[model samples]
Target: MRLSAEQISHIRAVIHECDPEARIYLFGSRVDDHKKGGDIDLLIFSKHLTERDKRRIRLRLYDRLGPQRIDIIIARDLSRPFVRLAYAEGVEL
Candidate 1:
């Protein structure tokens, strides 16, 4: 994982604040140590988060992390191929 301890803790704190049952996973380039620069890809499994909640969480993350690309996928409908791939490859945060 390319994320620092502070980054991980902050992220977990932010998410858990909203939904304590939420499960967070780190995927994409950041998961690969050999890989170079890429966006922060996250797949969150949460029963409590609606679309609005997801958006709010994202906005909060951006505010904390600053201007950068962060792709967040809510695991609501797992029928999507990418969602499956992300979950399979992801490392839980």
Candidate 2:
């Protein structure tokens, strides 16, 4: 995975602080060590959050992770195709 153990812990802490019930997954290129130059792909499943809250969560992540590119997917529904795919292949940190 692209993220370090410390990074994952930091992310989990931030996520829980924002939404205590949230379930998080680290997916996409970051899941494969052999792959290179892929940004961090995250899928967060929580009760609906306002757009502003979503933005804040993302900004918080970026702030901690530095300038590195990362993508956050706020998922209110796990039945979505992409989320299901991520669940199948992604790791839960």
Candidate 3:
């Protein structure tokens, strides 16, 4: 599905508020014009990933987006190697 500019902005806003130091990358079909059938894919990297933070993010996004399907992968800064590999392999938004 094509995401509206507003939706992207909302997502970015939530990410910024939830984890100011986090790096968020959009990927999968949500960012690919040639592909079909997929939800918004987000890879989030931060120095902190506490349970409370995760719950807050999920709750905030669920409130904004409703039941919309979203694939979110949260990782730590130490996982840069794997995240970089995924990016290099064509996971771009």
Candidate 1 lands at a TM-score of 0.91
Q: Model 1: residues >4 Å from true position, as ranges?
A: none
Clashing residue pairs found in predicted model 2 = none
- Model 3 score (lDDT): 0.70
Instruction: Score every model by TM-score.
Output: 0.91, 0.88, 0.72
Identify the leading candidate in terms of lDDT: 1
User: Which consecutive 10 residues in model 1 have the weakest lDDT in total?
Assistant: 70-79
Q: Estimate, for each residue in 26-74, the C-alpha lDDT of model 1 and write its tens digit.
A: 9999999989889999899987788888788888889888887888888
Candidate 2: segments with Cα more than 4 A from true spot: none
For candidate 2, give the lDDT. Answer: 0.84
Off by over 4 Å in 3: 78-82, 89-93
lDDT of 3 by residue, 1-93 (tens): 367777777777788797777777776677667787677777777777666776677677778877767767777754467666545543423
Better of 2 and 3 by TM-score: 2
Candidate 2 on 1-93: residue-level lDDT in tens?
A: 878888998899888888888888999988998898888888888886656777787888889978777778887886799888988888888
lDDT by candidate, in order shown: 0.88, 0.84, 0.70
